[model samples]
Structure formats: structure tokens, C-alpha cells
Target chain A: NSKVIQTPRYLVKGQGQKAKMRCIPEKGHPVVFWYQQNKNNEFKFLINFQNQEVLQQIDMTEKRFSAECPSNSPCSLEIQSSEAGDSALYLCASSLSRHAETLYFGSGTRLTVL
Target chain B: GDSVTQTEGLVTLTEGLPVMLNCTYQSTYSPFLFWYVQHLNEAPKLLLKSFTDNKRPEHQGFHATLHKSSSSFHLQKSSAQLSDSALYYCALRYTGANTGKLTFGHGTILRVHP
Candidate 1:
């Protein structure tokens, strides 16, 4: 079965602390995406990478959050400083390509900022 | 700016009844629409996708048709099942040359009762 794997299903961090979430894309997939889902179930796009190149990223991701998909390594999204508003479920998804593809998502990492 | 809009926040239906989830999008460039369903404690799974060819995409029992003129890809099912209870997300992929990010709408929660 095609599945995306995410590490640290849950994470807790104090305000101003840094937190990192990891994701392993499905085999043979080339695109990885990161999204943040708030309590209201509103999904906010963070960033997406095609192979090893950064394709597109939202302002929030480029400013406070950083994500990278290195060769043979799990994709990582790191928050430089945790804030109350940053507490949400971070989801990672992988697709065969940018277009004409279905994305396979991993069980999101729920982050809590104290 | 690209955005996805879902009409309903919650819909409760009896099993065997038909289900419809409305989705709309706004984008300057042509958009690729998609539907994703997430069960409790599980990651979101791709349900269907819309292409510019104007053909309806169907998977399992769910289907959606892309209307580029209206910018809608509403999901519909002939018969709702108890297993259909989940959070459904409507998404649109940006087709701009520089952006390949997906914009997701606030999800709709479906509750199918027996």
C-alpha cells in the first residue's frame, strides 16, 4: 500500500522553543508537501518540494517555518520559535508529481505550544 | 491569490441516502481540483480529482466533475454509507509557472447514521 510515514505523531514545546517534524514520502513519489490544519479544520498550505528543489512556499513557512527534502533523508519542517498560534496538526503529503496526481498524506503530527 | 471554498461545515445523513459536498475555487490560472477524505485518527486519503478534460472523476462510490466555467468540483455519492463518516477537504492546485502549492478549503465533516 502507498503510505506516507511521519515521525513523532505528537509533540509538545514551550513557547519560543523549536520543534521539528519529519516525513517520509511514499516510494517513487517525487513531490512532498506540508500543510497546517487548525482546530477549525482549515488547512493552510506551508510548502511543497519537487524532488530536491523547493517548488512553492507560503509566507508563513518562509518566515517562521523552514522545510527541506534532502536526498535519501526524511523531509523535515522545523519551527524556529513556537507560538500559541502555531499549535496545530502538521500534515505531510507526497504525490507522484505536481500535476495529474493524487497525494498520499501521513497521519499528521499534532503540535502543542505551552 | 488562489483559494478553495467548501459550502458546508457539517452534514448529517442517513445511510443509503445520497450525499453531496459542494466545492468551489478561485484562481487566475487553470486549477486542478481534488477531494480528500480523512477518517478519525488517520491521514487524509485522495478520493477524487478533476481534470480540464471536463470528465467526471470517480473512485469507489464517490465522484466529482470539474466545471471550469463555474470553477467547481462538487463531490457526490449515490448512496451514503456508515463508513463515509469522515472529514472531507476540497483542494485546488495552483497552475502558475512559479507556484505548485495546493490551496485547501475548510473541511466539511460528514456523519452518516445507520
Candidate 2:
């Protein structure tokens, strides 16, 4: 029922391995966001973008995470080195505008780090 | 800093019972509140959103009113259904901010048993 599409519904990786996930935001949506949901179900904001420009990102994301929403390309979030702590669901959401009240989310990529 | 608080981590109810999920928030600027529901292995979809004109938003038998004076937006349903079991999150983003960064609550898990 959601237009936002996320790829690789599941990912398995070893520690220090790179884990990359992609998301295609809903059609005509320009604002994209990435959030990490842990086993405890705590939602941690990772990064967000307005069109092709980065808007805001947490410090942890600035260090070990690489995310971008490029024109004509699906938005992606890649972990440089996966850790056990990084084993969680990575959710991508998009909205029609930067101030839009409603957000559409993807099924999310569940990463399992060994 | 903006934060959303969901008082209950889990709520168990029998089918046909009324459902209520409490949510509160603290924000620096004027914000819009929202409720999102995620079924098992599914993407989170917008259940309801607060209106600026004191309008109560509702979808799929669920409703929530934005009480700006109390800084609260609680989800409520007249009766619970078996299909209503899911994770519910309360989120908010400041209207004045150019960035659409949503501060989400830890989420409340609803279990409806027949």
C-alpha cells in the first residue's frame, strides 16, 4: 500500500562488512529520511535530504554512514563497516514537501550483522 | 530538542474493546503531530495527522485530536479488531523548520486477542 520502495528486504553481513540499502521514494516526493529501528523498537533518526542536497544528519551517521538522494537515482544509505549494534531495520520515508505533515514509509531493510 | 513520548510500551486488549494509546510531546516551535501504524513486516503508514484548525484526523476507524494546549495527540478507537494489532508510533515535526525531521516515540505495541 506504500509507494516508497526499499530493496533487499533482508541483508546478512559480517562485522566490518559494508551493508548498503536503497530506497525509491514515492513519485514526486522530494524530501527523504532514513531512520534506524533497533530490536527495542527505538527509532533513531539517521539522515535526511531535500532533493539532492543533505539536510540534516546525526553525528553517528556523519561518521560511519554514507547516504545520498541523487537525481535520477534511488536514494541509498551505506554503512562503511557494519557492527552488531547496526543490526536493525533501516527505514526510508518520503514526504511531498519539507514541511509536509504526512510521511510515507517503505517496508524497510532489515540488516543482520554477525 | 523535540521529543515524542509514548507512555505505554504495550497494550493488550480483547477484540471489540475500546483502544487508547497515549502520546505526549515537547517541542520548541509549533509542530504538527501524527500517528503511524506498522503491521508485521510491513511499512509504516500514516494513520492520522493533526490539523492546524483544531480538526481531528481519522483513518481506518482510528482517530486522534491534536491538543496544542496539552501538547498531546493520543490515538483512540471505538472498538479494537484482530487486524488492529500493530506497532503505533507518535511523531512530530516543527512546522517552521525547513527540514522534515520527525521525532518519533519508542512506539506502542497493540495486541488484540479474540
Candidate 3:
């Protein structure tokens, strides 16, 4: 089975707290992507990484969120100051390449800010 | 700017009925369309994808045809099973970029009743 592993399936944080989620892509995948799904089930693209380099990122993701895919480590998305609006499901996906490829997604980390 | 549009938010059908989920896209580049299916509490998996060869892609009884003229790649099934009840997303890949990011539509939830 093609599976992506995400840590902390559910997370709860205070308004000013920090939240971090990690994803281990499938065995041989080379690209990783982060997306946020809101309560309305609308998915917003956050950022993507090829190896350890940031390929593309949305404005909102660059401002409040930071992601890193260190060598041999799982990819991580961290929020410095979590807000109520940041409460959503954060999904991590991976693909073999950047073009004309299929993505395999993780179960996702559901974040709730109090 | 690139975006995908899924017309049906929810579709309820009896078992063994044909299913069609509408998908439309707007992009400046030669878009590569895809269909992903998400089961309950699971990650989204690739169902089918469209290339530039004007060939329709099909998998596990689901099919999608890309129409460059209409900018649509609607997902259809001859007969949907109860296991087919899930959320479906239509996605597009950016042409010029080397990033593996995908712009996705809102989503359509299919509920197959017995």
C-alpha cells in the first residue's frame, strides 16, 4: 500500500501557542506538499518542497507557517503563533516527481486552537 | 491564475446507479487534470489522470476524460458501489513550474445508499 505517515493525528493549542506537525512520505517519493483544509472542506495550497528546497509557497504560508524537510528527517510544518483561524486539517502529500505525477496523501493532522 | 471548480457538493444515489461528478478548470497553461478519491478518515488516493495525448484515463471503474476545449475533466462511473461513497477532488498541475504542487477544487461528496 502507498502510505504517507503523519504524526500527531490531532493537535490542540492555545491562541498564542506553537503547533508542529510531521510527515514521512512514502519510501521513494521525492516531492512533498502541504495543504490546509478548512471547515467548509475547501483545500488551500500552502507550500511544497522538492528535497530540501522550497519550490513554491502561497503568501499566507510564507507569513505564518514554516516548513522544512531535513536530510533523512520527516518533513515538518510549524506555526509560530497559532491563531483561531489556523485551526484546520493540515495534510501532507508526496509524489515521485514534480510534473505529471500523482500525489499520495497522509491521514492529516487536525489542529484546533482554543 | 489557475483554479478548479467542482459543481456538486453532495450526491446521494442508490446502489448500482451511474455516477457523474462535474469538474471544470481555468488555467493559462496546458493543464494536467487528475481525480483523487478520499475515503473516511483516510488519505486521498489517485484515481486517474489526464495527459496531453487526448486519452481518457480510467481506474477501478472510474473514468475521466480531459477536454481542452471546455477545460473540464469530469469523473464518471458506470455503476457505483457502496464502497465508492467518499469525497472526490479534481486537481490541476501548473505547467511551467517544476514544482509538484496541485491546485484542487472544493470537492464533491458521494454517498451511495443501499
Candidate 4:
């Protein structure tokens, strides 16, 4: 069992609808990361934050995804307009720090777009 | 850009047989190698990581050695177990500008039968 927590084990949304998922990083962890696992089991890095500051993100995430990790609130990743290609397993992981090599991942939220 | 390549998409084996999964990588800088295992409907968990000192990393009877010259970190186990069936991903973290980002390869599914 991982210490990281993700909400809504499954989510379904229609095209052009909004979809959101939440994740709570492990206690004492200051760095958080989000990844997408497609049907082919290929992993794509979306974004990462260190103590509420965005460290790096992909161009696709910048254009289509909204993500934030605020203090005293669970981190969130929301898609303004869900698309069929966006359907995937959203995984949230956390580490001790920006330089930590090991990441503790949560059970992902499976999103389906129709 | 950093990328990992897993040559085999699937490997089927009988229980008690030796296990080996090939993994190679390309990176501009010397990166940290990691292996993550995901069981059915479960979160991915770290299996092994490469040591900077060139020592082999092992866990649960699995081991991998990072070879900088070959840019490879092949996973191996002397004997396969039924419970070891899962999706295995090879990833690399660039220790350069973006330390939080991880580049992952298409996962290799391991099927161990009795």
C-alpha cells in the first residue's frame, strides 16, 4: 500500500466536458508529480511541483491541463475540455524532495471520455 | 531529452525459470535508472534502482546492474514466481536541469505460469 492518495477510482466524462482528479501526497513529501498511463501502458509525464511551485511541465499539459499543489489542499489536475485521447490512468506520485530518486505512487484514477 | 527502451513487449515463462527483461536508455547526462512494477489494478511500486557507485540493486530476488558504457540496466531473477507477473517499466531520471521529470519506456508485461 502506498502512502499517496488519489480520489475517485473511476471517472467518466463526455467530450467537451470537464474532468478533475485529486491527489494527496505522502506526509512530509514536498515534491509531487502527475503521469498519464495510456491503454498501451506507455507513461507520459504531465507535470511536477515542488512546494507549491511548478518545476516543469509538458507543452500539452500547459495547453490542455490545469494542475496545482497548494498548501493545506490536495493537489489537483483538471481538464477543461475532455477528449477521447485524454482517457487514461492518471497517476500521482510524491517524493521527499526535488532531488529524491524514489517516488511513492498512488492507485491511479481511471478516466474515460466518451 | 531522455528516453528508455524496453525491447520486449511481453515475456512468458513457466514458474521457477530464470527471468530477464532487457532495458536500454538514451540521455544527455548520466541519469538514475529505476524499475517500477505494477500488478493488476494496483499502483506502480519501485522494484529496484541503480546505485551511483555502480553497485547492483536488488529486491525480492530481482537484481539489475547499471552499465554506463552500454547504457543498459537489465532486470534479472534466478527463479521466477507466480506472483511476479506484472507490468514492468524502465525509467530514467535526468540529474541535469529537470530532476523531477522521469522518462519511461513502454511497459513490458511479464506472465509467469505454473
Docking level for model 1 = medium
Better of 3 and 4 by TM-score: 4
Model 2 / residue A65 / CA error / Å: 0.4
Predicted candidate 2 versus true structure: per-residue lDDT over A1-114, tens digit per residue:
889999999999999999999999999999999999999988999999999999999999999999999899999999999999999999999998888558899999999999
Give the CAPRI rating of model 2: high
- True contacts reproduced, candidate 2: 0.83
DockQ (0 to 1) for model 1: 0.63
CAPRI quality level assigned to candidate 4 from its DockQ score: medium
Candidates sorted by DockQ, best first:
2, 3, 4, 1
Candidate 4 scores an iRMS of 1.6
For each candidate, give the interface RMSD after superposing the true interface residues on Cα.
2.1, 1.1, 1.6, 1.6
Deviation (Å) of B47 in candidate 2: 0.2
How displaced is residue B46 in candidate 2, in Å?
0.3
For model 3, the stretches where C-alpha displacement exceeds 4 angstroms are: none
The sequence of per-residue lDDT tens digits that candidate 4 reaches over residues A1-114 is 889999989999999999999999999999899999999999989999998999999898999899999999999999999999999999999998666368999999999999
TM-score of chain B of each: 0.95, 0.97, 0.95, 0.97
- Give the alpha carbon lDDT tens digit for every residue of B1-114 in model 3: 889999999999999999999999998888789999988888888899997788888899999889888999999999989999999999999655567679999999999999
Q: Can you tell me which runs of candidate 1 are displaced by over 4 Å?
A: B94-96
Better of 2 and 3 by DockQ: 2
- Give a tens-digit lDDT track for model 1, residues A1-114: 338999899999999999999999999999999989898988888999998899888798889998999999999999999999999999999987776477888998999999
True-structure lDDT of candidate 1: 0.89
Residue-by-residue lDDT tens digits, candidate 4, B1-114: 578999999999999999999999998888899999999999999999998898999999999999999999999999999999999999988555554677899999999999
Compare candidates 2 and 4 on DockQ and give the better one.
2
Clashing pairs in 1: none
**Residue range A3-114, candidate 3, lDDT tens digits:** 8999999999999899999999988887999999899888998999999999999998888899999989999999999999999999999988898688889999999999
Clashes of each: 0, 0, 0, 0
